[model samples]
Target chain A: MHTLHVELGERSYPIYIGRDLLNDPQLLGAHLTGSQVVVVTNETVSPLYLDRLLAILGERALVTEVILPDGEQFKNLETLNQIFDRMMHDRHNRSTTMIALGGGVVGDITGFAAACYQRGVNFIQVPTTLLSQVDSSVGGKTAVNHPLGKNMIGAFYQPQAVLIDINTLHTLSPREFAAGLAEVVKYGLICDLPFYRWLQEQTPRLLAREEAALAEAIERSCSSKAAVVAADEREGALRAILNLGHTFGHAIETAQGYGKWLHGEAVAVGMLMAMELSARRGWIEPAEVVAFRDLLRVINLPVAPPADMTPGQYLDLMGRDKKVIDGRLRLVLLRGMGEACIVDDATEEELVSLLETFR
Target chain B: MHTLHVELGERSYPIYIGRDLLNDPQLLGAHLTGSQVVVVTNETVSPLYLDRLLAILGERALVTEVILPDGEQFKNLETLNQIFDRMMHDRHNRSTTMIALGGGVVGDITGFAAACYQRGVNFIQVPTTLLSQVDSSVGGKTAVNHPLGKNMIGAFYQPQAVLIDINTLHTLSPREFAAGLAEVVKYGLICDLPFYRWLQEQTPRLLAREEAALAEAIERSCSSKAAVVAADEREGALRAILNLGHTFGHAIETAQGYGKWLHGEAVAVGMLMAMELSARRGWIEPAEVVAFRDLLRVINLPVAPPADMTPGQYLDLMGRDKKVIDGRLRLVLLRGMGEACIVDDATEEELVSLLETFR
Candidate 1:
């Protein structure tokens, strides 16, 4: 097992990564301080892994279950209310604990639920999928999607701990696994060129879900995320670069309706858009864009954005993204193949030019 | 104008207490960091003072308004969502600021909204009524009530500044004015013996809306609230003492239906119950109870719990209050006038005795 600490003062918690750690009683038990626990999982994850986690929890606390529907579409105020309803129904107090047991959607919603439940509660993230384990699980960025923008209504709440059982990746569909790689590739593009090279070289091992390579990817991705989050936990300046493709990607998710395209799939296309924009501005060579696109394609991630969006549609949607500072659209665009920077200087005309080329 | 600073490390804000300060743009403008603002008010306060506040904002930023229905009954998640819906509808982003333009219900709801909107946004509390200016305005405790308890669903979010316009208090009905005095009296009973005596002597002046007495009352109450909040912003321990009558008060509000009795009115009766409990426990002399009850009666505040609720109902409801620690009800009962202490050792037998005697 590998343990990484997110250094957030008193709210700092550990991310425990290993095979079958969900069944490891010590890792799960060490963090929970309260006797009342609510395990929030989705229908899909509940069917697969709930029993394993429940067994690990044993008789440590009075555990209740709030099983939400599986998908991004269910991430809304209504679903969030359901969690609160359960919390109130179970008579859970401020000292009660909540465990999030699913991928990013479940984790995001549950984390926000914990953040708001009785002002705040101790929440542990038990991320099952690669997307959540590598990205959402480590960062305390918990939010649900709004119709206008993704994660528009949320809080920057840290969890008590994150328990990652990378063994759960065995259950992920191939498409789902690749969806998580988009964020992994994002780390390489933003801050770690060496990791990008490593990703390129280890594509076969990552695709095969080899233990060592997958573990390395998850750890490296988390380390980079933790370092950035530690520097700017609230995304003041440097952390905005982490949203390398998220502004366009969140727009894609918002415009298409949440459940239609997986978050990573949208991000994959969005990263390509970012790369294309970078190349247009002569920040990176055109060949780097091709190579990046090829790597994404090789990993079975979507390389092309949805064909239906007009530059006007993209403009309208992206303009409303959370990254817009003082009403200016601040996007994370590449300065070079391995360096990303927040670019707010791009005009609508420039965006249209890039969109026209892409289409 | 009297400006009292809440001494939280990074979250500290100033409370500007005086008559007609809402018209002072410099007071409001100096605290605001962004050019986008959203003013959230109730239907009750909108017709009275919303325009004056918007005028003070004065083309400084793009201002949007969300006018909600008034009353504690409306302080719920559904109504809170209306604020979010307007925020999304207006395309307000993280940098957009929110000004709460009403009493405690408005301040609590808007503060929670600002806390949750895009994780958080800068908010200002423009408290019109005496209660909010004295209590909610100084403390960063913001919440919307749940059906189960009062202020159950919310966050501990501070504002950029609190703008108090005592002139707006003239618009309050006599019953509402007295309701606000209930919390004012609580500050006196909790920690300030001199203020408690002042409240008793100045009830007539307070009821008459004498500017000098009202301003002094607001300033003194705010100072007490600020001191407690600065010490324990998240209600770890010391802050719980400020919730002296609240555990019982929350029960009364939840049981009798919100808006039936204003928060301070419910708290007025709850405070008497605490005194009665203190007397029964031999913590204070019986003379203190009679003196406390007389002052409340003179101020037009209730000194009795609801005749409809049994002791069991009170117990059931109080048990669900946020002040309950590890399933134990920790109540703020008086050690004597202006000296409050948290008591967890009160037996059900003693509570039943006190409830029966009061009944």
Candidate 2:
């Protein structure tokens, strides 16, 4: 088992990565000191692992489960309110620990629910999906989508602990598994070149669910996210880099209607667009874009833009992105494969021209 | 102006208290930093003081205003969403500072709106009503009511600065002014005895809207709240005392439906109930309960329980309060007149007896 602590002072917590760690009471119990435990999961993930999680929790916690509708379309205020409503209905206080047991959608909504419940409460991330285990579970970025923009209404609430069991990945569908790898690949493109190279070498072993390789991938991804978040807990500066492909990705998701495209899938295609724009602006070579796209394709992730998504439609949605500063679109373009920069001064003509190339 | 700073490190800001600080841009500009400002007000307070606030903000800030429907009934997630929708529709960002310009209701909803937008931006409080100018505007207690309990869903987001202009209360109706005083009297019962006596002597002056007496009252109330909050930021311990009349008060408001009773009025009656219970428990004498009730009555606040509420109904409603710990009723009772203690083991019998007597 590998333990990586996200050093956020009082809000700091550990990310436990290994086989069969989800059922480990020592790790899960460390974060759950409350009398009542509410495990919030989606329909898909609950039937598979809810009982196992309950077994680990034992009879001590007055545990109750709230199974939400699975998918990104349900990741809005309405769903977020249901979690709040349930917690209030149960009369859960600040001490109640909410365990989020699903993918990024569940983790994000659950964490946001915990953030707003009684102003804030302790929540543990028992991330079941690859997308969550590798990415959303580590960082304290919790939010629900607003009608105007994806993740428009949210809060930066750190979790007490994140429990990731590599065995759970066996339950993931091939497409969902590939989507999670998109964010894993993102950490490399935005920050670590060697890790990207490592991911390149370990792709086959990770795809085959080799425990050691998967654990390494999860640990590396968490470390990268943890360091960025710890330095800038509120994403005031350094943490914004984590949203390298997210601005474009959110626009794509909103354009497609949230659940139509998986968050990681949208990000995969968005990352390609970002890299292409970087190459067009002479920030990186054309060959680099090809390599980035090739790596995504190798993982069976979406590399090309959605055929029906017009640049005008993408541009309109991107304008509503939270990343937009002072009414200007701020895109995090890659200075190189392992480096990214926030470009807030990019003119509409420049963005429109770059966006038009998708045609 | 007397300034009180909520020492929350980076999240900290100042609270400026005086008679005519509304037109003083020095304090407002210290926080606004940029040229663009968005003033959030209500229909009632807008026509009264929007021109003055805008004039102080000046042409430098491309001043935008969002005038919401006026009332406590509007204080909910629906109204909160409107602020986020408008902020996004208008493309406001981290740089934009939201000025909450009205009574407690507007300040609370605006403060909560600011807390949610872009995962929280900056906001200043230009409290118009006496309740907000003295109470809600100073403490970082920002929230909207849920159906089950008041402030059941909210966050403790501190503001950039709280600007209290006593002159704004000149237009406040008598009922509204009395509601504000209920909170002012709360400080006396829970923490400061001398301040409670000072309030007793100064009640007539404050009721008559005398500038000196009102300013002193506002300053004292804020100072006491700030001291307690500084000791406990999230109401984890000592901060719970701040909810002196609030536990019972929230039940009253929730039972009557939130908009029917002003928060301060409910709290006024709630404090009376708390004292009667305390007296029954041998915590305080019967005369002390009358003293507490008389002080609230002197402020033109309600001392009796609501007409239709039953003991069982109040218990059922208060059981939903955030203060209830481990499924036990935790009531903050006065040790004497000025000091308070949180008793978690309070029986249903004691609460029932008090309610029966009130009936």
Candidate 3:
């Protein structure tokens, strides 16, 4: 098992990467300070992995379970209320620890649930999906999607520990796995150029679920994320660069409805749009755009955005994204495949042209 | 204006207590780091104070207003959802500062909104009601109520500053003013015996809204709370004592349906219950219980709980309160008029006897 500490001082916690670590009592045991444990999972992953986790948890604490309905659509105040209701019903106090046991949706909801559950509770992410393990599971960013924008209601609450079991990836569909890779590729595009090149070289191995390569990818991606989060923990300035493709991605998701396109898939196309815009502005050469698009395509992600959405609609939707600062659209544009910067003055005309070209 | 600093290291903020400080730019000015500001208020307070606050905020940055329906029934995931929706629609980023410009309900919902808006945002509490000025405005306990329990969903996010405008209380109803005093009297019961005695002697002065006495009460309550919060900023252990009457109070509010009884009114009755139970357990003398109940009655607050509810129902409700520790009924029992201790193993039979006696 490999371990990386997200250096957030007292809020700092470990991200453990290995195969079958979910059943490892040592990893889960380190974060359990109390006797009451509530495991939050969605319907899909519960049937597959709940027993393994329950077995690991043993008879130490009273383990309560809240199984939510599956899908991004369920990620709202209503679903969040359900978790709160369960917490109230069970009389779970601040000392009660919450364990998130599913993909990004479950992790996000559970983290936020823990964040607001009695002012906050100790929550550990037992991520069961590639997307959660690679990206959502590490950062303190926990949120629920809104009808207007994706992830509009949330908090940046760090988890007690993240227990990532790579073996759980076997349960994910190939398409879902590819969707997660889009975020894995995101780390390379934003900060680590060498990692991007390495991802290009190791795509086949990662897709084939090769243990060593997949482990390396997850480790490097987390390290890059931890470094960025540590530097700008709240995503105030430098962290906005991490939203390289998220602005366009949020719009795409909102326009298409939340559950239709996976967040990673939308981000894949969004990254393509960002690169196309960067090329138009001469921030990156046309070839880097091709490289970015090719990598996303290789992972079976949607490289080009959907054609039906108009530039105006896209721009309007993007305007509603959380990244927009002071009502101005702040686009994360690339200097190269390895670097990105926030562009605050990008005009609607520029975005419209970029959207037109992509369509 | 009286000033009290909440001394929370980096999260520390000033509580400005006086009349007409809401329009005083210096209080809001020092905290305004960014250009974007979103003022959150409820329907009742908005028509009264939102415009004045908006005028003070001026055209600086992109100023937006979100008006939620007034009352505690609206203080839930649904209302919190509306605030997030408005924030997203306005493109309010993490840098945006939210001003909670109402009473305790508004301050809590707004503080909670700030806590969840992009993981967290800078929030200022411009408390209009006396209850908020004395209690909710200073502490960082921000939350939305749950269906099963009051404030079941929330966070302990500190604000940048708290501006208390005593002038706004001129418009407050007598019932509302009395509810605010219930919290004011709480400080005296927990750790400030002198303040409690002073309140005992000066009930009319406070109820009459004498500026000097009201200001002193607000300042003293804030100072005592500030000291307690500074000692335990996160409510780790010692802070639980601050919730002397809250276990029973939460039950009253939940059972009566939130907003049916003001938080302070429920707290007033709750404090009486605490005293009754404490006296029955030999934690405090019976004479102390009489004094506590008489004081609540002096303020025209409920001494006895509503007659409709059963002791079992109260037990069930209080059992679900967030203050419970390790499946035990953790009550902050008064040792005397001025001091209290957390008694974690209060027996249900003892509680039933006390409930019957009180009933």
Candidate 4:
């Protein structure tokens, strides 16, 4: 078992990574400070893990389960209200602890629900997907999708702890597993060169679901993210770098309609676009962009945006992105491998020309 | 102008109380650090002061107006979504400042909207009613009501600054003005006995809307609230005292349906109930409770729960209050005049007897 602490002063919490950690009642029970507990999971995940989590939390004075419909499309205010309705109906108070047990959608919505329920309460994250275990669960960025944009409404609320059981990866479909790799690759592209090289060499082992390699990747990804979040709890400046492919990815997610494409899949294509644009601006070498594209291809992730999506559509959707400031679109572009920079100077013409090349 | 600073370290903000503070562009503009501004006001206040506010913010790069319908009935997630829709429609970024220009409902919904929009942005409180000036606008308690309970969904998000213009109170209906004074009197009952006495002597001037008396009441009320909030920002311990009458008050509002009973009016009655309960428990004098009820009656505030509400209904509704901990109802009861304490040991039988007496 490996534990990494996100050093956020009073808000600091640990990320526990290992196999069968979910079976350990003590590990899960330590974070449950209140007598009552609300386990928020989606339908798909509930069938697999809800009973196990409940059995572990069996001795609690009260335990309520809210099983939401699974998918990103359900990650909106309407669905968020469902959790609120159930919790309020059951009379969950300020002292109740909420445990989010599912993928990113479940984690994001539940974390947000915890953030707003009675003006914030304690919540824990038991991320069951690789994408969530590596990205959403560690960063404290909890949100729901809006028709206007992805993650348009949310809060930067941290969790009491994040429990990552590598065994859950065995249940992931091949496509979902590949999608999670996109974020694992992102950690390399954004800030860690040695890890990028290590990921390149260990790609086969990672894809094969090797426990040692998976644990290493999860630990490194969480460490990099935790450091960035500790430095900039709110995305004021340094933290914006974490949204390297998110602005473009949110555009793809919003334009394609949420749940149509997996978030990691859209982010994969978005990261390639960011790299391509960086190459055009001479910030990164074109060959390196090509190499990254090949890696994504080998990993079975999308290397380009949706075929029917136009440069104009991208511009329109991206304009409403949270990254846009004062009518200017802020794109997180790669300055070089293992480096990312927020650039608001990218003109519409440059973006259009870059999108045209995809045709 | 008298300014009271709510010392919250980095989140500290000043409450500017005086006549015509809204007319001062520099005061309003000083806190707006963004190029774009969104002024959220209700229809009742829009026609009265929105144009004046827009004139003051005319020089901004972009100014958008979102005018919602009036009343607390509109203070819900559906109405909150309207602000998000307008902000997103206008492409307001994280840097855009949201100015809430109305009474408590508008300030709360707008503040919660600001807290959630793109995971929060800067917002200013331009409270147009006496209720907001002394209470809602000063503290960072921002929320919208849920059907099951009032303020069930919300955040503890502070504003950039609070601008209280006493002149707006002159336009308030007599009942509304009285509702606002209920909170002013609350400050006396929970914390300051001297302020309570002063309110008793100056009730006539306060009722007449004399500027000096109103200003003094507003200043003293805000000072009391600010001191409480500074000690406990998230209502962890010290701040629960500030909700002395709120748990019962919320029950009254929820029972009567929002907007039917003004928050302050319900709180006025709730305060008396708490006082009566305290007296019954030998915590306060029965004579003092009558004295408090007399003061409320003279001020035109409701001094009793809705005649239709039963003791059982109060128990059921109060069970869902945010103050409930581990299935225990934590009521903020008075130990004596000018002193408040949270008590969870009050028996259901004792409560029923207390409610039966109201009959």
Candidate 2 lDDT by residue in tens digits, B68-120: 99888889998888877787777677778899999999999888888877788
Q: On residues B33-112, what C-alpha lDDT tens digit does candidate 1 reach at each position?
A: 88899999988889989888888886754778999998889998889888898888877888899999999999999999
* Residues forming the 10-long window of minimal summed lDDT in candidate 3 chain A: A54-63
Per-candidate TM equals 0.99, 0.97, 0.96, 0.99
Q: Order candidates by DockQ, high to low.
A: 4, 1, 3, 2
lDDT of 1 by residue, A214-251 (tens): 99999999999999999899989998888988887887
- What class would a CAPRI assessor give candidate 4's docking? high
If both were scored by DockQ, which would come out higher, candidate 1 or candidate 4? 4
For lDDT, candidate 2 versus 3, the one ahead is 3
Indicate the residue-level lDDT of B284 in model 4.
Answer: 87
Off by over 4 Å in 3: B23-26, B33-35, B281-283
The global C-alpha lDDT for each of the candidates, from Candidate 1 onward, is 0.88, 0.85, 0.86, 0.91
Angstrom error of the Cα, residue B47, model 4: value is: 0.9
Q: Where is the poorest 10-residue window by lDDT in model 1 chain A?
A: A55-64
Off-target runs (Cα >4 Å) in candidate 1 are none
Over B215-253, each residue of candidate 4 has an lDDT whose tens digit, in order, gives: 999999999999999998998888999887888899999
Shift in Å, residue B36, candidate 4:
1.1
Cα error, residue B15 of model 4, in Å, equals 0.7
